[model samples]
Target: MNTLQRRNAIKDELQNQKLISAKKLALKYGVSRQTIVGDIALLRAQGQPIISTVSGYKYQEAGTAYHGVVVCQHTIEQTREELEAIISLGGEVVDVLIDHSVYGQIVGTLGLANQADINDFMSRVKNVNHNLLASLTNGIHLHNISCSDEKVFNSIQQRLDDLHFLYHD
Candidate 1:
């Protein structure tokens, strides 16, 4: 198949599967990993809601859940507690966003849907050079979290507030 066909196929695979690695895509399509990377770039340029996570590339799904952005301030040490609080309360931590003087709005996808995801994130933060966006903004950041219902959202808000992590403006 050609580049167009391969790209279309990649789009389909992403839509159908929760996550697929570039390596797996390359093997399936008989192309180099770089080819798959270019295909993903073109697909994203065409407006596909594809997000690359530590696990793999997947399509982000929007459902009936209520989504809200909560402002928070905390040290890097509190990252695990903050993430656990949200996930334990039935909220999916979608992303962390911060306003940078130079870059304007910057976002880092947590995609922390479960305990394992959060653990992996914290692990990478410790082992890699990935800087937390909050570091650039003096420990103030925002989390885009999704909840199944209003009650869950309220619980998350209350917990974060109690932890003194919620930024009040």
Candidate 2:
């Protein structure tokens, strides 16, 4: 009804579901999309554990997840294989990082936790016609992966090695 009520409702809606788009929430709240975006920003400032993904925003649970950085070099054609090896072993590829000589570090937030997420991400990459960060460095990049245990991390490393994607450096 009011701004506070609408904000609270938006929070409740996000809590009760997996994800919701700002446009959809704006339509439901009879407000502009920018208004909903502002509400989300304010809610985040107030410390909501909301993560914005391509599909929408979702509440994320903080847990004792094991995180490790996997450095690899691969062609654009092997992108799916690299992501699949990590995701299949219960690793969520949080982000991709590339170090450049002049510009320093460039990062891309992937948030890829499953095969479906990987698929969607790759599709968007194709649709957008953006270059993969690795291309800038001739296929060398690092992926920060979060998993449930060291075992999964090891498996991911071994799988990447088997795929010949693991960069020695």
Candidate 3:
């Protein structure tokens, strides 16, 4: 396929598959992974609602979902539990934000919406041996959560509070 065709195909694939990696897209289109990355960049530049997550790229449509940011502080060992608590209460961990000493604010797109996504993220955390963004700030960070309503977000907040994960003065 031509460049325009391949990029269009990539957009369609993202919409259909929900989440896919550049490697997978490259394999599917018989192109280099870099080429797929370029395609994704071009697509994003064109205002496509595509988001790259820890797992892969997924199309994110504008929605009426309630979004809230919660301050949290916990150990690395509590990462899974924190995420689980949020996901179990119908909260999507949209992203993690941390204030770095050098960099002002760093945001990591998580896109963790379920148990499976949490599992994959935990696995990657172990396998990648990379420090989570929170580690930089002594386990203090902010999570932008998306939920169906304020009620669900409240439940998630309560759960995190119960788990001693919510940071408060």
Candidate 4:
């Protein structure tokens, strides 16, 4: 297939699938992984709501009602507990961000909405040589979380506070 055709197929795949990996897409399309990455970048430039996560790419839909940013601090060992607290309280962990002394701001899309997503993310972190972005800044980071309403968002904050995951001055 042509480049345009392959990109179109990739966009369709994003809409149809929950998560897609660049490696898997390259294998399916008979292209290099770098090519798939470029295609995704082009698609994003053209206004696709594609988000890259640890698991894979996700096509974000506008069904969410409320979004809020939370500051959190915890050890690497407490990552799973923090995530569970947020997810169990009906918050979708949209992404994590940290300000680096050199790189400025770094962000990682999470899109973790359920226990399964959390499990996959945790497993990927444990099994791969990948390090959490928060690790760069001494376990302090920001999370953009989404929920159905402000009530749920507040509840998430409270739960995080209860768990001592919320950062405070």
**Highest lDDT model number:** 4
lDDT of 3 by residue, 88-135 (tens): 898889999999999999999999998999999999899989899999
Q: Is candidate 2 or candidate 3 better by lDDT?
A: 3
Candidate that would win on TM-score: 3
> What are the per-residue Cα lDDT tens digits for candidate 4 across 1-169?
9999999999999999989899999999999999999999999999999999877888996888999999999999999999999999899999999999999999888889999999999998998868999999999999999999999999999999998999997
Ranking by TM-score: 3, 4, 1, 2
Measured against the true structure, the TM-scores of the candidates, in listed sequence, are 0.88, 0.86, 0.96, 0.94
**Candidate 1 local lDDT, 1-169, one digit each (tens):** 8888889889998999987889999999999999888889889999999987766788987773799889999998898999999999999898889999998999877678888888888888888967788989989999999888888899999999999999987
Q: lDDT values of the candidates?
A: 0.88, 0.88, 0.92, 0.94
| lDDT (Cα) of model 2 | 0.88
Clashing pairs in 3: none
> Which model, 1 or 3, shows the larger lDDT?
3
Which pairs of residues clash in candidate 4, taking residues 3 or more apart in a chain or in different chains?
Answer: none
RMSD of 3: 1.0
Candidate 4: C-alpha lDDT: 0.94
Location of the lowest summed lDDT over 10 successive residues in candidate 1: 55-64
Better of 3 and 4 by TM-score: 3
Show where candidate 2 strays beyond 4 Å. none
